[model samples]
Target: MSDNPMPSSFDGNPEFKEETAGQKLRRRLREEPLIPLGCAATSYALYRAYRSMKAKDSVELNRMFRARIYAQAFTLLAVVAGGMYYKNERQQRKEFERALEARKQQEKRDAWLRELEIRDKEDRDWRERHAAIEAAAKEAAKGGPRPAPAAAASAMASDQSRTAEAPVEVSEEKKKGGVLDAVKSLLSGGK
Candidate 1:
């Protein structure tokens, strides 16, 4: 009885894996075939040599012994060749992986730099707006004649004292020192 049953068709069974004789042979051959071939040849030659000795045939025994040595040498050479190929493949794969990682890191760094530049530009714009507001305030102070600080405070207090249905926020314009004083301050500045 078979422990594993291979489905006849994949249409009926998704897990079914169908392989033709040639496909199986090619796959097996690609999976390091030389060493196994050497081993088989060596074992057959040794068996033949044993049988020749049993039959009391010295010439056949000598020939089989030589064949066994040649087979072993072939297997050794195959193993060495396979090892070299494996090492070369591994080194190339490692180099490819390293290059891929470096490219990903470079992309990440470029994104970070772009984000930093955007933030810096935003900060620069904000500072320029603030400086312009300060310049306007200074110009207003230099204008003809300005009311005293005490009068200004009194007028602000009177405005706050006005009756209203809801509690209104006071002096919203100068809340964060963003814009000029009075009506001009109310006309500008969001942040």
Candidate 2:
């Protein structure tokens, strides 16, 4: 006979094997209800204390004094345990909220980065196309004889002088001051 106990078929399965802390707590609570018992013990101790107080004899007052004290102590411990459990729950909720917010912020940053990358790629493609067009234009211009630097400068100067000497012609409505003239005349009482 083997010293070790035989393993059950269910033991091989992970789902059937291990219990979580919450599950263990639920099982323990179901098996033995302590909190209610503590409350009852406390109430019984208080009643006993009240009875002892009412009793005139010192012997009667001394009866089961230790049991009453023990009951009160257990009740105090139970209340403290409940307070600790509440604090833990609150802390867990706050941590979960903070983590969720951080995840949302991270997702927003990732989306913004993707948008920037797409725009940058489009700009790069446009620049490449523009550079290719400029290169082709230069290659085509190579067939023609280039003008002298001094002649080019003089031609540009003459063009600028011609433009400067010519008077700029305004449209009929623009020269007449359009809506502004009408508004001014109305405001000035036909003056």
Best by TM-score: 1
lDDT of 2 by residue, 23-83 (tens): 8678646644666687688677667766877876556556646666787787678767765
Compared with the true structure, what per-residue lDDT tens digits does model 1 show for residues 1-191? 63222222323533223456897568647767998899999999999999999999999999999999999999999989887877865465455546546656767765765454444444444575567556657877889355566875675455434322223233532363322332333434523
TM-scores, in order shown? Answer: 0.33, 0.31
- Candidate 2: Cα lDDT at 130: 62
What is candidate 1's CA lDDT for residue 79?
A: 89
Top candidate by lDDT: 1
User: In each prediction, how many residue pairs overlap at the backbone (N, C-alpha, C within less than 3 A)?
Assistant: 0, 0
Q: Quantify all predictions' global Cα lDDT against the true fold.
A: 0.63, 0.57
Off by over 4 Å in 1: 1-29, 90-191
